[model samples]
Target: MPSDARSTDGSDPLDLSGGERFGVWRAARARRRREREEVRRFTAVSRRRRITWIASVGGVLTLAVACIAAAYTPVMAVREIHVEGARLVSSDLIVRDLDGELGTPLPLVDRSAIKAALVKYPLIQSYSVESRPPSTLVVRIVERRPVGVITDGDAFDLVDVAGVVLTSSPRRPDGYPLITFEGGSGSSGFAAAAAVVRSLPTEVLATVDEVTASTVDDVTLTLADSGAVVAWGSSEDSAAKAVALQTLMAAYPPDAVARYDVSSPESVVVDPR
Candidate 1:
């Protein structure tokens, strides 16, 4: 027999047994198990990072809402009130006028309530209230002007150009005209009488003693310089009548015209006693 063909199990090169093969398989299986464990660990770490990111965003959103709420709350209340454009009016009183709304939210403050309160004071003709955030309140006022003095019982009241009673005074004003009217008449009649007096010529108006609005059908003027009476039937044709009276006074002496009737616009009736 040839030496190469002879059977020699003991001399076989690189021969592996069943136990060795099983050992190699076991080693590979161990490596795959370790790789799977590593992959699971990485996945767990990534999931924890995603959870942390979501929590951070939610925390930021909640903080922003809280900050906004704090800004508009009482922490940012109005600290000062600035009063402007008020003449012949006490700023303290005007501030007192807004006292009812003090400490109120500027955004929630009612303008109508402030206006109604201000209107209660006859001197405040018009007013404006402004607000600035994080602490400022501004106010402006316009006061009414006195046109004449009105007698209401023992006290005298100041009247505006529209004949609206403004305020009462202990003593009468020196330069303003005096007005007298019958109590119980409508305000329209008194308003008309005031309008007519304002429409009179300056020279004639300066000499007027008292303007009486006793009846709608008749209006009377008493002269201050001479204590003479001028009968004006009504407020109708008042401007024309005033002009006619002016011309008559210029042409003829006031003494000659005792009772001047300027009720008619085109003609004049004079009665001299």
Candidate 2:
């Protein structure tokens, strides 16, 4: 051993040789390289996160601008109007009534205003509105059905089951019976008469000439050719009463029986004149 490498206390001491110095230098260099690699990884992750956030923000802004442009532009405005399911009311009238909604945007049409205009026609029972994109608006309506005719001096007023007068004509229309109520069409008596008339079978309905009701429970019907009368007490058990009347007519024939009382359908009464 060289004098310069001697132990201070004659014990085995650390030797600062050239080989040991090289090993220390290698350990320090490895530590610095690992720290640099960690920093590079962190920087890469942070840069990727910033890029993702920017892309998400840009996409949201583009969608918002496109929607605003579509809503305010005239490309989506109503240019045509179509009316459907209107029978008694003319399609021309519905289109004319909706004229104010023509230039408005399809998404901004006022449904309440459309309903207000249609309410002026008493025949429209129900209605719906639909928008056809790019330029069209469609309105569908269900009209009231007339069941009977009421005598109105010089003309006859056609009425539905709810007693709404649809139209008046100079003479009676075919397939409808004359309805006479002690009170006017608005009375409960007329409602009962309407129910009885509406419940009659097609064969029996065609045979009815006149219907009269003083009260809701005193409805009566007169046959056309045979002139046989039917006493329908009330609107209750109407289906049963119709069946019983049909059976009685079939068994006795219209000429043999003067009247049928099916008000209490369980105990039907027949009067032969």
Residue 11, model 2: lDDT of: 59
CA lDDT, every prediction? Answer: 0.76, 0.90
After superposing candidate 2, which stretches have Cα over 4 Å from the reference? 1-61, 71-74, 152-155, 250-256
**How do the residues 1-273 of candidate 1 rate in per-residue lDDT, one tens digit apiece?**
656743476455546799998998999999999999999999999999999999999999999998768556885565677788777677888787677666766766778888777777777788778887766778888888766788777878888866667778788877667877765223756765677787788888887777877776588887776666778878888889899878877776566667777888687877775
Worst 10 residues of 2 by lDDT: 1-10
Write one digit per residue (lDDT tens) for candidate 2, span 6-53. 567865566568999899999999999999999999999999999999
Scored against the true structure, residue 37 in model 2 reaches a CA lDDT of 97
Q: Tell me each candidate's RMSD, in Å, in order.
A: 14.4, 6.5
Clashes per candidate, residues 3 or more apart or on different chains: 0, 1
Backbone clash total, candidate 2: 1
The C-alpha stretches of model 1 lying farther than 4 A from their native spots are: 1-92, 95-113, 130-147, 160-164, 185-189, 201-203, 247-257, 269-273
